[model samples]
Target: MHDIAKVTLQNEMDLILAHKRSMRLAELAGLSLSAQTTFATAVSEVARTCLESGKVSYLILCVNTDQRDKFIVACLKNEQLNSNRSREGLEHAKKLVNKYNIFTSGTETAIELFYYIAPHFRVDLEKINEWRQLFRNEPSISPYEELKRKNEQLQDLSEKIQKSEAHYKTLTNSLPLTIFSLDVEGKLLYANEWLERYTGHTIDYLNNSQWKTIIHEEEYATFAVLLNKVITQGTATIKTQARLKNKQGDYIWHQVSLSPFRNEQGDLQYWIGFIVDIHAQKVVEETLKDNIELKNTQAKLKENQRTLEKYVDELNRSNLELQQFAFVASHDLQEPVRKLLFYSDYMVSNYSGVIDEKGLGFLSSMRSASHRMRNLIQDLLLFSQINKERLNFTDVNLNEIAQEACQDLEIAIEEKKAVINMSGFPVIAGDASMLRQLFENIIANAIKYSRPTQAPVVDITCKQNAGFVEIAFKDNGIGFDEKYIPQMFRLFQRLHDRTAVEGTGLGLAICRKIVEMHHGTIWANGQEGEGATFFVSLPLNTPGN
Candidate 1:
């Protein structure tokens, strides 16, 4: 009983394997049948065969392929039956396939078998063929039809764009100012009809040729340079004056404003600009400038005339005061000297023997004082009259003038043993006589002050400046304190004792006045016991020198 049970389990295993092989073979053959029906049929047949065979323990069928098509294997408990079943089933199926012209295979086991339908016959061939034929008969549209529809839509869009462009052009042309654009290469790209109408050039000519030729010759090169710079810098706005041609072929001054247009990437696409005629404004500005200049000139002339009249009146008043001063000084100065001279002559002639030595000495002193008083009065008169008269200026060489002054003072210079050094004096415009007098007074002072020195040296030198000449008179002598320089130039302000320096103390005062009258200045610098230098700065060409 145990052995019989083991054989029964083996037979059941064979049937299950055979059924699995049949399903696998069908799948491999690409069968389109429902899995439920195929599985039920294969399993039921295998079960019935297994129950009838008591000797069979188990059976199984397996499928294999060798290039062309699928084949099946059957396993059975009876060795003979299992070996012949596959052959017999294969032959029977082959006959069926050959008779029906179908590509298929089938086999069996002791309790089970398998049958396979090739891909060509396993599926629903009639339905598949009908689908393929229907696909072949389908219709297609022509390429031109689709393209024509797209073209129609594009044409509509193009028409709208053209209308919008025309409207923009109309608005731009209606503007009062001339508007135009230039390409990146500075060639005229687009211009409104207003430009052609105003400039007397057709749109074709303006766009094809260089716009610079239409610009005035004087402004063409400048405009080209500026426009090129604007493009190179990517964008710029420039206001420049240019001469633009009008419809009548005449040039008109225009103020042009050029603003560059650029793309989103900051590349210069073109320049847009406007031109406005400014000839009327320019003419008005020029006329106003001329009128203002004329008014300023007239005002200046009037002011100058007023100043001249005031100067003339001042000169007359100064002359009158000078004459009065001279007269009063001469009269008051001569009275005391006349009495002293008369008394001195009477005392000397009548009491000559009776008077003692001291009395005689007193009379001699009186006579000397009288003579000095007369000389002082004469010098005062000369000083007052020096600049009271009119000045006559001419080219006067001071070298020659200084030589003459030296000659005039030859005797005094000789007596004092004064050595004068003079060189390189400039020829200046001045009154010859006044210049001669000026040199005489300064040279005489130098000689008188140098009396105490063993070798009296007076050096005279002249240096030329931008508008004046600086003359230096330096003397090596008994110099005074620098503190007394200001007082020295004042009348009757003597620095030395009366007995030491014999003069009315009026010589320097006269020198100052003479220099000032010639529009010059005089000052002195000195240190005690060293020397004194007088500096005179005279204008090179003063009206009265």
Candidate 2:
């Protein structure tokens, strides 16, 4: 099952929207007009029940397929209800849909309705995509309808506020912070009890004096400027810090924020403001500014720096030993394989008279296996050695790199009759040997994977981007699906079979390591049977050069 559309049922209007969307999707899925209405009505009934529970619910329309049938599925869930609070509504909706099921797990309840598509009607990814686009491009509600929706929402909000007005006042009076509201004309409308007790001023006195008796004189000037700007512009919310005189006659630091409240038509209605004491935070800041405390912090930071450096040194030493062991192990393991290849050749040349064809073939297979093992070990050693610490940067010309790579693959290019086109090479700072290897591996793969019926063609192009140079190697070969791109660059991750193409599967992996060492990137693009292009982007100014 795949969800194509989702709507949150927050109010009555959302239920209406859900119903409309359900009918549209059903029609798009090749349902009759009557069937569309029936399915849509069923979904809306369940959605209404969930919304009436006084919590937000979700309705997701999905396309699900089984072996023999395709279904348009609607899943409506409400997490606040554990039991079936609308059992009758569910039964009614169930009768309208072709199939229905209700699932309950702990506090969540989900109802799934399925409308099976007729066998003659077609449903596929392309059709599903069309349905999604249609939903996004659906025409907006008419102006009259929109106005009615807004009016309904406003009425609901008004009723809620009226019912909760007493509780709201009690909650604000018990809170430690100050809450206040102002009219559009900047007149003081109301202030909570906390503000009055903290400042030892009544609401009437605050209104007459404009709170000058409570606000510190030094900060009042800045506060007034910001407040007047908010009143005149009525733009975004603004927050500032000021010192307000308390009942004990101490000026304490407080954070004040003023936000303009707008009505449905986007007209500024009034302002809401809050003030919270932040005297303790200000004292902490002052303490941190002291020179002695700053020096102590610096001393601790230096100690941590030394500890981190010590650990880094130990890690580098361990890495060096591991790299050396890999080199030594690879060299040691190659000797026996080399000897086996030599003895096999010797037996084929000197003992041919005593051996049967089957025995000769066995020796041939042993020699082949030995050679592959030798190549694998060599590739592994190269892959392990290409790292940032070992990189030696220089002013290298990429044209030379391309030429060298082509020279290395001269035999394969000639065998495949490959045409190599190169142009727009640039000079950049990079490791010479590694860059050459990068070009060689990619170019070699281009030739090796060429279509058998056609001669191979490899195009090498370069472009200079901001602070970097991008080089692309495009090949007319038997390419791969772009999805296999990530897999192809991983060590021992190959898209082609060993019998079809011969390599250790570490070529692209090594290329990536070399690119990363130069603070660069490598990627490729291709389609099956169409060919592929591999891009390597290197920085013009190499890091640590």
Candidate 3:
């Protein structure tokens, strides 16, 4: 590299220095007048861009040689990365120069413009140093002449700026979007032709109203707030969406973005904003939102179903364990209970003669206690089996069920002298054995809880209503308080004294389990001292149906 001259670009005068140095270097290298002017103008364009950034920059004019060619180069460099503000000027300079290159490293930017030196020109290091010495020793011009030169340069720069501004205006007007600018006080500085065409308002009107007339009334307040916030702060970039009314009196969605344009010193100059149509994108987003919600709802339902299936599997496993327990209780436990009852009965029958009256009474109590224990074990086995096995449904005559239940409890009914009244019946879909158990437990309860003063009477009646077979068992027995209704169907929830009623307290519980398995309902209605009526409603169709 052979040094020609270097100038610091701080003001308009520095631009002149760069321009003059570029022309003098080209002339010393034997360039024609036209080429000198072109090179000078290109260097001036780049220098002006650097100066406009409101920061100090350097313009270095030098001659560089490569293996293949020798060249004169003008390189403009800045310490700050403000290349975006200099893009237009750089592009203009590129058209005038033979070759140009731009580079950035960290916060610095360098734009190098090159012109090839003709091979025939015998330029050497000694001649380049002489040119440099001439510039250093050159006499200063008179103050008047310097001022006149500055005015001519300023006039030429103003003409170039006007032409650039006209070119940008035409380019923006040809585009499909609305481009705008605003001052720090929210005053309209400039608006493109697209804005005027879309809003059907001239730039003069927009300047007076600040384009607020074209924004939808519903969003005007929000838009105003955003504009005011950006103007007040003058340091942030904000983006928002609103309905902008078109010339056809239709409001369409548009996205608006505003950015603060600042100088190198970080002072706010103006707000640059753009508006683009986004009605189609907004519609798609809304549609996707609804689809997302629907998918979420479906996902929740599937999750709930999976959870329910998990619970059902656990219930099935628990029932299987209970079934195994029932097997053990019936076989292992019943044998010992049977032996106890047998020995107690044998003691009473064989030793009554040897035993005194008090001893006989003790033996009799033992026999009775063993009998109660046997009944309790049997009831427990029945309770465990209900949930363990699946129902076997068939067409069952409820009349026959009632009759079979009565026969099963004939001994107890005979002992109580209970009167059983039969009424019309209906054939329904149910598990025959479970339905029989349900009836038998209800009848036995009626016979056991009969008032000591009256003979027990049970009337069994059935009728078809809706899709169900409704059966009512009206018993003239000692009724219970209605408030205990919730507890009446629970296991081991006895309402009467053990001495008064010989019960295992599991009869009603087993009945309820059977009714539930068949998808039927059972409830009792009665008051104290009044006879109770138990109503069972079984669906006519199968349980699953």
lDDT string, candidate 3, 1-545, tens digits: 77677777777767766787788888887889999999899989888888888776898898886436778899889876366758888888899988998899877889899987784656777777898888666554557436644675688799999999999999989889999987777777798988878889987786678567889888887678555744457458888889998899999999988888889999988889999999999987887888978789889999999999999999999878887889988899899889988887888778889999999898888888888888999999988878525688889988898889999999999988999999968888888999999999999998899999999999988888889888898998999999999999999999989998899999999989998888889999997788899988889988567
Worst 10 residues of 1 by lDDT: 1-10
Candidate 2 residue-wise lDDT, 405-466, digit = tens: 99999999999999999996888998999999999999998998899999999999999988
Q: Write the per-residue lDDT of candidate 1 for residues 243-300, one digit (tens) a residue.
A: 8888788887888777878789877767787777897887777768889787898899
Pairing residues by index, what is the TM-score of model 1? 0.40
Q: Which residue pairs collide, candidate 1?
A: 10-57, 10-58, 11-57, 11-58, 14-59, 14-60, 15-59, 18-60, 18-61
Q: How accurate locally, in lDDT, is each candidate?
A: 0.68, 0.85, 0.85
Provide TM-scores for the models.
0.40, 0.45, 0.45
Number of clashing residue pairs, candidate 2: 0
Off by over 4 Å in 3: 1-317
Question: Model 1 Cα displacement at 60 (Å)?
Answer: 99
| Residue 332 lDDT (model 1) | 73
lDDT of 1: 0.68
Clashing pairs in 3: none
Model 3, C-alpha of 540: deviation from truth (Å) = 1.3
